[model samples]
Target chain A: MFKSSRFPIYYKGHPRMFVKDKPIFWWALKWVHARFIIRELTSVPVAFYAIILILQIRALSLGPEAYANFTNWLKTPLSLSLHVISFLFVIYHSVTWFNLAPKAIVIRIGKNRIPGLVITGLNYVAWAIFSVAIAWLFLNLDNLM
Target chain B: MKKSSEPFWWALFGAGGVISALFIPVILFIQGLAIPLGWIESPNYQHLYQLFGSPVTRLFLLALISLSLLHWAHRFRFTLYDGLQVKHLNVLIAIFCYGGAILGSLAAGYYLWLI
Candidate 1:
């Protein structure tokens, strides 16, 4: 039989271990905590972009007049400011995601593990390629069609 | 042990993170910022409609919208659970977050199909 002291089994009336919860004040004041909070907050802007795109598609479905109205709204100062803010937040998210990629992905060949910088570098390269491809497609939509 | 559904959601979060990081920036820049700000010429409605009419474009839009929303759902769920210390309401929060994402995705699909 396993010893109770060694195994630390839970039973009736067992005392639970105590752990301190992270303080809200630390989250507000520390740079590391701020980065973590900001990273999570990026989700708001991402979700916002998704909703905007959905509305855009809906407007497109409504007809040219509706779509034009949506575009005009998009051109407004308020809309422009929101896009600018969200764009900045999204860039931060992207940068943080890429920097963390090396930690998440581990590549190895034989006895050798691929360097983390190499993994991070590849992510950046892929990001650049995708961005360029999307830009090119949009910019040349008329010519391509 | 009972199977946990955590991995399923985690996989979605990871995929969404990658997609948003790589594609969303440029999409937002062009469609949301440059075109609207008059820095880049906006594509005409006819051309945009024609583009959306393609099945490939529709599929891409569906994927982008759905996954990005899912990413938000998963991330926000954790943010609420841990950051806000609302773990006691975990089930309610999970349903609310993921349900919203699914509904938004369905709306996107419906709109895309209409176009």
Candidate 2:
């Protein structure tokens, strides 16, 4: 598409003009491409969470004793290996989740992209509040039991 | 089936949404029942496993996994074509993407059923 604009060019790949001919737009385009790759790679955590969800279901279906057994085993060295891997996966999932939140929910002032980082940051803030509330509720529940 | 006017990826995305939304809720419901109601003395809460327990839930989960993976596969196919300078292999990539999704979904279903 960039090539279509009819601009007069005398030399085709002449070594003398090479340095001067390179446009700023080329560098900016490459930078944007790299950013897309970064975004895609980081989103692997989203897929990883789906696998984790399946694993949790399997553990539960095995019965209460099996569930306890699984939990106990999870504390062991071998199980800890998987846990460590899953921990990394969970972090990735959370990061991607927050990243996507901005796209899924539009926050606009007349007309705007809403600034992606600002949208992502607000998601983290909301999660923090939710976490505190849940922790408080869980602690109270534990006391009752 | 309709392979001319529309691309296969669109179908996969629609299928995935239908599958995941249907299965995840059912799985949640079955598992949620385990929470004590104070009425039953010894409730089998563990039976309410996520999306893996009941036959019906398993079917939906399998469908979800298949459709979703396929949908993403289609997405990645387009990504490869547009982003990676792989436009020449677009047709091959699209087929592979759909095939992989179907295979993945089937594998998920099989594994869930076996246990």
Candidate 3:
């Protein structure tokens, strides 16, 4: 678990002011700021994947030729790099999302709080169902379209 | 602060659920912008896509982004304050975290419009 630092002070009979070492060094300050920015930017890939999913669905609907062209374009080196970064983002997002899941939905039955792992398990089940539904629809598009 | 921390986690949990509920279903259903489920489609998904594509969707997106940003900002603000024992530059850090979300929401809005 991420936690704050606990500094001990051993002064008796008086209240002493407590403070951490100041960030007098510029490099250290810059490093701290950069770390926060990087973590926040990691969320970008989740946004990107969402956009790509939309585009891929649209392209597929257009035609097989268009879908092939779009996917081929997506497979290019630059696109691959973006996908790689986005994949990392997706993993991070999923983990954070899952870790945060139990708190999101709490089912209470007969005076017992639902387990967090149970919540996560249900989420995975839902995602599985959703993925299958989408795949099924797309696979049968020829007949349905 | 410690006493209130318990409820903070609960709030965070509720916020996360709200975010997922709004995002996931749309993602699962959106057949690549082609299968407009609700308003854009026939009676099958009518009123649904309309709900998502309408100004209301934009509003919800804005709210989600804004609220989530604030939620994230608050989490990070304390992370810095407590984890790093940051005290001197508290205001500056607060501004960056919350301001980043404000700016981010604006960007999301622009993209939403472009799309």
Tens digit of per-residue lDDT, candidate 2, span A95-136: 555766666667788876588789888767765565455334
Alpha-carbon TM-score of each model against the true structure: 0.91, 0.44, 0.48
Query: Against the unseen true structure, what C-alpha lDDT does each candidate score?
Result: 0.89, 0.50, 0.53
Better-scoring candidate (lDDT), 1 or 3? 1
Flag clash pairs in model 1: none
Candidate 2 residue pairs in clash (backbone atoms < 3 Å): none
Residues A1-145 of candidate 1 have per-residue lDDT tens digits of: 2122324454455457433445534567779877898899899899999999999999999999999999999999999999999999999989999999988888899989999999889989999999999999899888877
Query: What does the lDDT read for residue A90 in candidate 2?
Result: 37
Tens-place lDDT digits, model 2, residues B23-75: 33222222222122222222233334432466776765566566656545655
lDDT of 3 by residue, A37-87 (tens): 554454444345444544543454455576567756754668756655555
**DockQ value of candidate 3:** 0.11
Task: Assess candidate 3 and give its TM-score to the true structure.
Answer: 0.48
Task: Say which candidate scores most in TM-score.
Answer: 1
lDDT of 3 by residue, B1-115 (tens): 3465546644743463345333534443343232432223322222333334468655765565545555556566666664455667788997896677567656666645543
Q: Could you report the DockQ of all the candidates, in the order they appear? A: 0.61, 0.11, 0.11
Q: Which candidate model has the greater TM-score, 1 or 2? A: 1
What is the descending DockQ order?
A: 1, 2, 3
Residue A72, model 1: Cα distance from true site in angstroms: 1.0
**lDDT of model 3 at residue A15?**
55
lDDT of 1 at B100: 97
- Identify the superior model by DockQ, candidate 2 or candidate 3: 2
